[model samples]
Target: MTLFTELRRRKVFRVAAAYAVMAWLLLQVADILLDNFGAPEWVFKSFTVLLVLGFLPAVILAWVFDLTPGGLQRTPDAAPAETGVTADSGMAGREQLTNRVILVGALLIIVVMATERIWFAGRGNALDLPAAAPAAGLAEPDGPPAAADPARSIAVLAFEDLSPEGDQAYFAEGISEELLNLLARSEGFRVAARTSSFKFKGSDADIGEIGQALNVETVLEGSVRKAGDQVRITAQLIEVDSGFHIWSDTYDRRLENIFSVQDEIASAIVRALQLELDVGVETAGRTENVAAYDLYLRGRQLGREPSRAGLLRAIEHFEEALTLDPRFAAAYSGIAEAWVWLEDYGGVPSTEAYPKAEQAARRAIALDPQSAEAHAAMAFVRQRYYNDAVGAARSFERTLELNPNYVTAYNNYGDVLRDMGNLERMIEVHRKAVELDPLSVFMRTRLASKYIDVIRFDAARELLDEVLAEYPDNDYAKEELANLAVAQGRLADAIPEYRLVHFSRPGDPFSAAMIAIVATRLDDRALAGAWIEAARQQGENNRWELLARRPLVERDGDWAAMAELGRVTPGPEGALLRGTAAARAGDWLEARRLLLEALQLDGYDATQPARLSHMRTLTELAWVEQQLGLEDWEDRAAVVEAVVEELRRQGAGSIDENGVSPDYVMARLAAMRGDRAGTLAGLQAVWDARFLSHWFLATDPVLTPWREDPEFIALAEQVRAHAASERAKLAGLEVLP
Candidate 1:
């Protein structure tokens, strides 16, 4: 018989066919299961090796064995009679078994293909699914949507360091960040902010959960192994909801080809997501020099820590990068960014740090005008230091134009809008920032602050509470909660909150000062004095010293010292302090001038009465006008009344608007008009709102007319009693609130 005919009779061909199909099926299943479990690539290699080894053994076994009615036997030993069949019958039986085996294998192959098709189709649909809307009431009406289209949204997680010593973590992170920046710069791609993505660096959280938190549909994760000049990068694009890999690749190249590897990974991702890459679009890597790139990445890693020492170290690294490659725009931008933080963290005076930052940023732009980081650095310097609101806005616009997914640009721009008294725009920008960086505590806190600015107290409280629950040690969120409580006239609630922050950051002058302010308001003079001393000891003679002394200025009549201190202060807050000092010293004319100057500095105008500080400034100005004379007070009083009424109509229903308790203003107005009932009513409101201090009611010049009234005395006692109870409660806390 022919060899093929002999093989068919023995069913070797059917067994080989079935073995091939089964091996393919097993490998497919193993590949998926191993990847899902995050098994090392070596595990897959081992699986493939075992499959190869089993193939020869299965073929040899099929050649040696035969099917018989009695039992299995060697092919040469089997005879038709011993098997209780004739040659034709035995051949027919073997043919039927072969046909059945072939049919079953074909069916299994079909089933496997169908299963794969179903899985891939489901994953594809998940990628295209519309993003889930933000929780109801969490989004503002005019704000940007909470999530972008899923097909175009992605989050690049920090890559793992698989180097021999596991010491290339910074290099892996830098590569991931570059990929994120590239995707962010790509048209129609919405990438999660660095802060949000890096939050999952060491976490074992499910990819689907991470995707939901960051508001992205796809996630790119990878690992890097570097040895000397050789580097291997393995990256995979995953459908977040299904946790299915859309594409995966490993690039083995020299360090000099790192930029090319990055480009290849980005292109692979674009293809996997079915995105159209724009022609001539630049990728994120700028420097071809590996040393300079490494230094720049280290600088960026250090810059994330917003501390004086951290920024200083970041600056050093960035400067070293510049020395290596002066034309590297990213390095220059990093220097500019580091300098901005240096100024912010009090590492350098704004006057010195800002100009240097502007110079570095301008140089970066000159080198690479399309750089989003360059534009963002310029915007930050202009907004925070130069106060050039128009220039800052233009820079911010250019920044977003270059990289629409730059969350920090949005966040910084929101601050500019806030400083310019554009609450709506501020809220809108901050909402977008939070959307892009949903897992970022800093971003969420900033959004909450904007919510508070718009008087959406419940929303602000909810957001702050959520952040605090997740990150209980977050001082910024705690501080915002305290501010919210103070704004609501809940001083007792605010005091404990501020004390928590104070105890946590005992050396932070701002925290100590806030505690001092709240303590004084609670009538705990000893506690207030202790905090004042604490603040003074912690560099209270510097630019931040004014905050530490503010409580004393308000409680005691220390106007002369405050005025001297204010002469060196520079900003709206400084002007307000000077005005208050002038007012307390009985210089109404100077107070009126300084107060108006303060209002102008704060961007206050009748047309924009929605500014949080506007009503407060107007109230102060009206009080100063009343002190000037009753004859000249009508115009000022009319203006204040008009603004207050406008704000009330705008939903700021609080009697105390943005920290200016209107009780003092109302009592002054009533006293001037000789309205006895109005005077008593205003005092009663003050007591109810916890705005009145016992010393102010007893000795203030404005309330002298009603000092002898029985009802006014009773209101003063009520305020004092309430203060005492709060003070006692605070004292019971172990933290010395």
Candidate 2:
């Protein structure tokens, strides 16, 4: 007999086919289960390896063994001449039995798969909502998780521009965003954030995949066409699971009636979803002028671009829109957002940008009291610019009340909370923002930075790893990783991460500035000088240059130059830095005056590295008071103690940033109080954590008394030697300059 015929008779082919099919199905099930259970990659890799290794063994066993109804038996060799009726009858009976067994196994697998789908659906494996209830002001404290009503969640995709020239893409996006905003305002409905939803624009992703990515149950998508004074919009709401149309509509309207058309579409969606009429949307902050609306949309799209030039252009478009429609509240809010970002991201001075932002935000609020975007912008300005925490908090609360799904409000409010020294509340607010916009690398990285500040190293690393895995080239993610290393006192690991960010964003001065500061802290003056020159070459005369120069100036004991440099710097940082330099220069009266002015300008900022600066200012002010024999030194020392106590209460007592630590302040206080044991203990803790900068340790006035102590001498020498060794490792490497 032919080899193929012999194999068929022995059922080897059937066994191989069944094994292949079963293995594929098993792999699919394994992938889902392993991912859901958060299994490590090695576990799945080993499972796959074992399965592949077993394939040959499984086929060999099929060749060697056979099943019989009467008893267990090895497969009998095929007979050369079995031409009898009984032989044919026996073969047919065995074949029927084998088929029945295969059928039962397949059905069992199907049943298991179906049950798993239902089980995971109930546990929110598909929706991927946070297990904890959001404690941000938008939600009740410790309320049920938002996942409980994930069935009501929806994503609004960017509508396709079907205009003849395809030049109305921005208009189409604006319509979709407006609808998204209106739906998000609904009381009980959950709408995905714009950043997460718009990521699928022009993608070939199916509705189900988009829904899964955004963690939504429904998807709204459409096409828009505009020609002269007429507009046509077609929209459909699709059920993600079934890929079925839940509702659809097409509208042909004059351009002037676009606002009403949006209102009607939003109301129809609410009705189709069976949402209450009381929770329906209102057409607030909308303009009737089509030309102005187009300009507003263009401005918003440009504002999202991550560049200074783009922001400047966006402001121009927003101004044009406002000129065409003076009462365009949304346009004013857009302008406010652009100005705020110009300072925070685009290298503009806060003095120049914050006022413009506040003015535009005020105009928007005046035009429409219920505009959530307006309130959010004002809140950002109040906190980040004016440092008015109470006003910012109230504005954030009102913004959330108007639109509970305003992700930016939650994000900025989290910053306000951080500035107020409420780390726990800040994290809570950030979590809510992440839940609303989970795919935003910016939000995730920002939260990771807070984790680093609080010394939650593992949590911070996990978030950064997740972001880097998807966005390998993200400069912000790399910077945060470097920040994490610095917080942990891993100076060696941090330098390369900062360099990576510098290389990726060669035109940005921020990373070069960081590298210079880090090199100075390591006592690598040559490398520091190279990076400083590189930063200067970046061409923007921003705060980074002054910041990068401070440490090098202090290292040289050129207090006069340091003070002069700080005077030119802006804000409380500059004042405090100038004050510290003046004190080191023996100008106690000038130091005290500058320090008090600094405190008056901004009481305190509880976020790193600003927190470190604040701590430094208070410590130096206390020391200056002691030099001038002022009793107020006691009050400043008391305030420092209170801040330290608060940090301990928050479980972040060990927080360190860029070689600065609260322990340094405590050690100084101990020495001032003549507590030798406490002073040594604090110094030991700082040494153990590698949180000492060599120059600061060498020059500190409080430490002058301990200079003769053998242990203190050894600690300082060890830190100096470590910094020298780390610097020596890069001795011959070419630097930026």
Candidate 3:
């Protein structure tokens, strides 16, 4: 028989095709990585697919011609009955087949090696640095403002593991993290991020290199040595710019005293940094029970999300910690937080969980007299469970006073302030959070979007752009970017970003909903339909019960689905879901009635209350209000505008609005009403926000009407100049992204 016929009989073609397909998959993966890491648009998925196709010819050649060994081992004529070969002969034939296989493998390896070496090498050099340098005023290691202040800039090095048993790595890491958190919580200090500082844990990076890398004025390093009940820790605070030891200490304590470790470390670090921390010695006493504290730590490590399973596990740990030391205030608070978290995450009823959260929080304070976590927990309960804004604010304030650098302090405080119409302070607080957690992609995104909330798209865009550049993989950024693009009428640019978001988080109903929205605009009915169906498949996702919330098409739908999830199925979020379903099902009045009923619960109800200020809820509420708009049309419209504006400003990241942002929506609405001035205002906001992509700004359809406006050009230039100035400030930075 012909070799081709023999190969067909042996199914060699199918085998070669399988290998080719695998090669193709690997090639696609490489392309995806490159794209995600900032590769050029010229890079195509089909490019990798074609690379696999290249192997097809070689594979087919092996099948078509019997030139390679092991090419046709399964010939039909070689059947055992027909060949009549003895066992010895069969063994000899197998040896020959093995030799053939080895030859084929060797050749294939060489081909793959050559292909990878040549094709992958040039792909890494995709980014093009601009010829013009960053503007003249860019700050670097040589002279950070913090360097001059000495009090604000700081770096935290890895703490030494004190445990002689050598299995306390998690403990040691937590200690360092807590110290970092303590410092981060303070408004008086500029603590480095976990990623930036932790990058040097076992590295040879000295104080000088670390200072330069972190761009800080002071560096803190310490070592821990613990044996059984006894522990010893030595720490030194060094001034990076001057290479001087600013403060030093060696501490010895019993393992049982680790309860006080968190507060003690915070005080020491503050003194070392020379900051005027209002918090002092008594604050350290707040960590009353070491055992309870340990339990809390163990609980934190148990679950990925705040689900009931994780919360239950966390509750056990927190309880144990408290049991080891009943006076442990934070442990009691931890138990409270865990229970409250479980209400939303574990799917328990608010009646069951909210009261528990409140009780636990109260117990913590009773036990410790002064617990930051306890205060925060109480605030959550009051806000979510009791609906007492005033009380919640008081507790939130207490938490901050106790620990100014608390990350959540700023977030929760800002949220409350916003509800009170204190937008300016809210922005300021979030700004502090962003500074403290510069490498926190999540915080930055929130900060940027908050800027948009006050109709300050310019600032929001700048922040969002920075977030996208540094953490392009963030679905939040991508969604906002897509929305911004669509707002600008740049459907082409907006589509890919939206699609990317849905693709990255296939099970995220919000993303799928956005994808559907964008697809509808782009006339991709099929894609839109497919995405909507997929969105329907993703269960409920939201957790909070709030009066106002970020505008979202899928929150009611998707989050309700999440409510049905085994964890958060029957809690406060579930109630919101039932309410949302009533609204979406065209029973607008019923929806309003249900939501109002849910709102009657306390602020401490926890989950949805925290995120209630979202524009989506406000917009829907406005619609419901409109259905009964006899008494307050102007007031209602104003409320709607505020909600819309707030949604527009969120996540802008210190820059102005872009195409996909809601600014375009307002601008268009104004234009349709012959509000030329308003249109111009929106257009100006978009241009001022340089955080968006050139592709998005250029392509979105929302801003199409504004394309000819003279103000647009001036605004764009101004934004670009501002961006240039900012980039110049980070010219020689390390890990601040």
lDDT for position 117 in model 1: 62
Query: In candidate 1, how many clashes are counted?
Result: 0
Model 1, 1-737: lDDT tens digits are: 45676676566777788777778878878877866655655677698889889988888888898666668878774454443324668768777786787788778888867876664553542223222122121111232221233377999999999899998999999999988987887777799998899899889898999998888888999999999999988888787877876666566678888877787677656545656564125743377788998998888888887666677788899899888888999988998988887655432545567889999999999989889999999998877665566678899999999899999999999877754555567788999998889888989998887776566889999999899899997988988898787666677787667777766654445666667777777777787788777655554343344555655555675777778767765656667778878887789888989988887766565554334445556666777888776455666566666655554444443333223454556666777678889988877776665566776676456677888999888888887787787776665565353
- TM-scores of the candidates are 0.75, 0.75, 0.52
Per-residue alpha-carbon lDDT of candidate 2 for residues 42-85, written as tens digits (9 for 90 to 100):
56658888888888988888778865565657878767884322
> Which scores greater on TM-score, model 2 or model 3?
2
RMSD of each: 8.5, 16.9, 27.5
Q: Rank the candidates by lDDT, best first.
A: 2, 1, 3
lDDT string, candidate 3, 1-737, tens digits: 45565565444664575565556556657655754443423354466557767776766655554432445332335553432323467655764685566556657767766874464332111111111112222122122112123357777776867576777655666677667756765665667766567667778878999888777777878776767777666566676755655544455667776645444555545543445554444455454455555566676556324345666787787777766776767667777777766654453556677888888888878776556878998988877666566678899998877766566667777767755445677799888776655666667777765665565656768878888787778877876776555444444565567667656643334555555554443434455566556555443333322111212223223434432341342333344545656654567677776555554432323233232233223333444555555344334345546645554344322221112344544554455345768976866666555333232333333345666667755565564454344334434433110
lDDT of all predictions, in order shown? 0.73, 0.76, 0.56
Using lDDT as the measure, name the better of candidate 2 and candidate 3: 2
- What does candidate 1 score on TM? 0.75
Error of 3 at 50 (Å): 79
- Reference-based TM-score, model 2: 0.75
